[model samples]
Target: MALDGLDHMELEESKGGSGLRQYYLSKIEELQLTVNEKSQNLRRLQAQRNELNAKVRLLREELQLLQEQGSYVGEVVRAMDKKKVLVKVTPNCRVALRNDSYTLHKILPNKVDPLVSLMMVEKVPDSTYEMIGGLDKQIKEIKEVIELPVKHPELFEALGIAQPKVEWST
Candidate 1:
């Protein structure tokens, strides 16, 4: 019997040959070695990832601490800039006034009385007075009231009073 197409087929196993078994065992060993090398590479990559995560966590904690410290320092600077003003009318009497962040203090002798006065002024144009023509009498009265302190400072001082100072400009 002549087998033309199946001439090259191996019949080692059917013939109980040890050569075929040895070839299969060698292939298995090669595959196991390849698997071990791949597993070691995967472990190295995982360790690198874990180290990066720890560094990120440390940086976040430092940033939070710095922000808290900045707020505390700001509050301390504001407290230091606060102002308190003190005024003394006599040896037994004193007065104080505070502006935004400044303090003013005044002291007077036993025979002299200290008088302090605070005034607020709003600036308006002279044309505004002409526009409100019907308020001529009212405007005059207001002007007199505003000038009373300048015209009679001695009288105000005799009454133990301090007049509000005024400044007018264009």
Candidate 2:
């Protein structure tokens, strides 16, 4: 009876050992799956970080382009040779131009300034000064000043004086 009881105890211990092994294996597998899921999430986040870095680099390049400073326009007065030109950029100064800097186009009337472009905008085929009105007094003044000097020269001669000259400028 004592030997039988010892054998029965051995059998119970063996079954308990198998249960503990199964529990350890299930726990280990759960931990391994958790690690795999965290690794996948980390990889996804790293890829998103790389994509955002690329967008930032593109925006930086665009900002640099928008911050550029200077280019000015000037006229070429004369072509000196193939490599240079005389450019008149200021009232009293003349600067040389590069070979590829200037181009020549047909003259277009400058209509940006109304005072400068009054009657000089373009040449009409049939234009007349008759369109101007309300200048009778001004026209008579001009005619008297001009024709009096030519027609009545003796008046000035008799008075021993020269006719007064007038000049008009726009």
Best by lDDT: 2
Give a tens-digit lDDT track for model 1, residues 39-112: 99989989999999999899999888666521110111122344522333233433332333334333322334
**Per-residue lDDT tens digits of candidate 2, residues 1-170?**
45574576567568876755666688999999999999999999999999999999999999997775433344556779985566665422323333354443223333256776686847645633366588878767876777676668788789797876655432
Location of the lowest summed lDDT over 10 successive residues in candidate 2: 90-99
TM-score for model 2? 0.40
Q: How far is candidate 2 from the true structure (C-alpha RMSD, Å)?
A: 18.4
Q: What value does the lDDT take at residue 27 in candidate 2?
A: 90
Off by over 4 Å in 1: 1-9, 66-69, 73-170
Taken over the whole model, the C-alpha lDDT of each candidate is 0.57, 0.65
Q: Look at candidate 1 and tell me the lDDT of residue 75.
A: 10
For model 2 the local lDDT of residue 51 reads: 100
